[model samples]
Target: EGEWKVMLFTCSYSVGGVHGHLVDYMQPEAVSTLLGMTYGEYDKRYKSYFGDVIRKTFFDDVGFVHMEQTWTPAITEIFREKYGRNPALYYPALFYDIGPETGAARIAFYDIRSELMAEGYVRQVSEWSEARRMRSMGHPPENYSPNSVVAHGDILKYYRHVDIPLLDAILCFRRGLNGFKQVCSAADLGDKPVVGAELCGAYPEEMDSAMLYRTTLEAMARGVNFVVSHGMWYDTDPQTVRIPPLIAPENPLLGPALKGYSTSTGRSCMLLQGGRRIADIAVLWPINAIQAESYMFRDAESGLPIANWHPNDVVNYALSGMLTNDLHRDFTYIHPENLTDGKVSVEGDRLRLNNAENLQEYSVLVIPGGGYISAGALARIGEFYDNGGKVIALASLPS
Candidate 1:
């Protein structure tokens, strides 16, 4: 029988978590890109590995991936050349904006509702109205888009610093489907085999398999075909199995469903085995529980609230472990007897991997910066660069 392939739901740096963690996804030439070396310098290092494959096939090893906020025509083209497949992109549902930067989105909406009216969309009208009001005041409400038509109702400005300008970006996408109709118009993404693909804090912690299963069933009936699930944030730290801060320990987030999916991950299909799946329906479950138990999510990362997103806060307060049920007919994720034995960790703090010596043996690492990584870590990352290691760092590297 042929092996069943699994898709890994990952955002380039979300997989890394920090600069040293960037070794989790690095290639030799990536090191040159870091130190500002010319492609020739990169090629010099590249030849050390497998000769011309560096110029020809290095990126092929990384396979299919989507940048959370950096999806562009050029990026799309790059993926096509390497994977021979279209790449999935992440578009936030918060607001829409597109044009030659004439600020068309701002003028398009008489308010948020008018755009919906223009698009003839009627689902969740009140929510749209609230977002409109917030946008007008230079403050937009929070929103999550699992699929085009289906959005969760966990709106709240957890960012503290409002995302009013995000409206422009969303407008660019939404109105494009209708000749720049209204900036606030959503993309013509009506039930396009949507996947909740990934979520941070859309579900409340009180939710369990019953709620997750029921929601999945309804969304699928509405047009969604699968559920990729948002987790299994394992790393080689071997000491910290961090989960997101929005899950509850006793909730079904730690149940059998996820474990089944994890086993699906270990299968030998080139895609699944490669660890690159854009989940169609991801339940952001248990990491929430781990956070609540430790109160890690409540603290801030360099002043920002740790559980920065409120719905995420609710999730962390609810989950207990990392076991998933079989949304598919296959394997599951089992709870780690020792948290260190697993890959996901959630002490709630961002940007701390103990010390510098911990960065060996990793091929690619991610450095997530809510704003910026610490100076000490930054220098350590420079060493990683000097050593010809690769990093998938954010905030630390220029995009």
Candidate 2:
């Protein structure tokens, strides 16, 4: 029973802030209010709001031990009260210390896996189906590919030195194994198919380039099944230095539908059609990109990183999606050194795409986000557009 090889998602989640976003939000009045309530009163209100099963999931099964202390329980209670059961997302929160059990082949988190390693925990990560990636290249690919029990060097390092239960008021080390554990906790309970996480330092520049490549390969060795990019940006948020969403209502017809579609199945179908990508293999392929930094027009210091780790941007992804959607090519690539590697070649104003190995057969060629571009690159782009090629640009504007 594995339904898919990998499951793609955003990683800024946790149970009550246990994983990526666990910050305590306790207040005196919050608990005082909870204690003041009577069980009879609470039960009546609970069912009156949230239907039956959810009422059981929270108050019965879990006892909601500290529902008031954790924001989710309280928030979940509200959702159940009004909407009956919470959306599908409510139960499978990674923070629950209980991973998703939808049974659609399982995927696990690299951040959580790393913590297990540090704490002398082990698992057969390969059994899971989803791709496993870490935020940054913490180690080398050759190191973990076969899923050995060597326990990463950092694990040994921390075992010998570093302290546990330390708090990093700031993101002390976005990629340092210590850094990940400070915020996240394991939820898979030792069951998963393919393993992957939002690997790579928050920004590609955090660790030098060479180190980045090694870390990715290492994730493979550690039994990480795939690497969905940390993210692509919607826009930029300078205060947070995060790659924010490029979230503008960019002509619903031209970009993502401003509104979601009706029916979950219908919504999924529409999302696939709107130039967005829905990958199948769920494998790991690292591309270099700032997680998310959007500075439509700003200076470097003032520049914001679109928050999600989008090593490959929309234009290229859209293009890739077009190829995947339209063509049926069994793929193979000569390991691109970078997103804009020699795949699309340009020599003295002559724009040519060599290594058409997989792409040569496709009718449309879409190249989206790459790093900074030069006048020469624009010229080559113009040439490609002129050659009767269908191209879609996400953040890349015309010359």
Candidate 3:
């Protein structure tokens, strides 16, 4: 028997998938079923529904086994039943000799926001009993979360461009800015040109490894922590699930090139991750404005509601980017709700970011746009101004 370390670095089961068999995870029926089994008021017994479903899906459809089976020595009841005694072997212990084992849960930009509000989207037929109760109570209401809406054009954009950034503004960004030493960026978000940021790309058979290294380095002066080779093909000859351009042992130059790049970038990330970020500016995330725009508009061409970020892309993307990379001054995105919740505090001419142990004191609060700002947010801003903290409002003041 042997043991090995395993870490799931890339898992996107949260949003499902775009193409390939993984897309089955995104299907409405399957998603609805999974959502209900996990979050819906089915019973305490169904508490493990979400994990069990993931296990069943990956194991039954794909040849790959679940993480628990791979990492742990625990035997399942089925295995115990099949054999008279406890099964002596466990894979990957059964497969290869692994020395020390470690497991870390990794995620892309997605937070637990979607799961937190799962009940809002219970399938109508599935909720027939609940629907009856609502009807008896006078009127049933639709889910308020924007994810429930059907938009014309690409649905993936709704998640990629909108939900991710919104969560960043409201929750994740604060934690990231305050405490995280090294920020892990994925292909989509990491693609932004930042001084010490990483970039992800795939397909080595088609692309030269040298070019990949050079281009990535050229994008950022300090280079990247690591270039995530989007994927590696497991079996070259059998090619059963080949999604080329294959880049692993199969691609001659890729492995060595990446190794070299990693070696070159090693100390850079170490140094970058050590320092406390300095910021004199705080940007008030205009989430309310974006939400209002989403509710008010439908695209003339696609008949879909405009992409959630499209309405305020200027403030969210361009301005933020200008401050982040172009200006080279560190800034934090302030969620409006955080103001009402006392997460943001004012002290004489400075606004203090309170979510972290090392409170980030900022000299100026920059409020982007003048759309549907909440009264609480306005009051907080007013208090900041009253306390002599400088405030900058773009376009117009909140009405």
Best by TM-score: 3
The most accurate candidate by lDDT is: 3
Q: Tell me which of candidates 1 and 2 scores higher on lDDT.
A: 2
Q: What digit string (tens of lDDT, one per residue) describes model 3 on residues 1-399?
A: 599666332223423322233322323465567546653564345435433442111001111111111111122333455444333332222223333310000000011111111222222222432332321000011111121211211111222211111111111112122111111121122122222222233233455676555544433332233333334445665254354444455566565676766676565545544223456787775545543332212322334332322343325445555565567665665666667877677778888766333356789988867455768788888988998889987765655
Put down candidate 1 lDDT per residue, 112-140, tens digits, no spaces. Answer: 21222222212222223233332101212
Q: Residue 243's C-alpha lDDT in candidate 1?
A: 38
Question: For every candidate structure, what is the RMSD over all alpha carbons to the true structure, in angstroms?
Answer: 26.9, 23.8, 21.5
The CA root-mean-square deviation of candidate 3, after full C-alpha superposition on the true structure, stands at: 21.5
Query: Among all windows of ten consecutive residues in candidate 3, which has the lowest summed lDDT?
Result: 102-111
Candidate ranking under lDDT, highest first, comes to 3, 2, 1
lDDT of each structure?
0.25, 0.27, 0.38
Better of 2 and 3 by lDDT: 3
Error of 3 at 40 (Å): 18
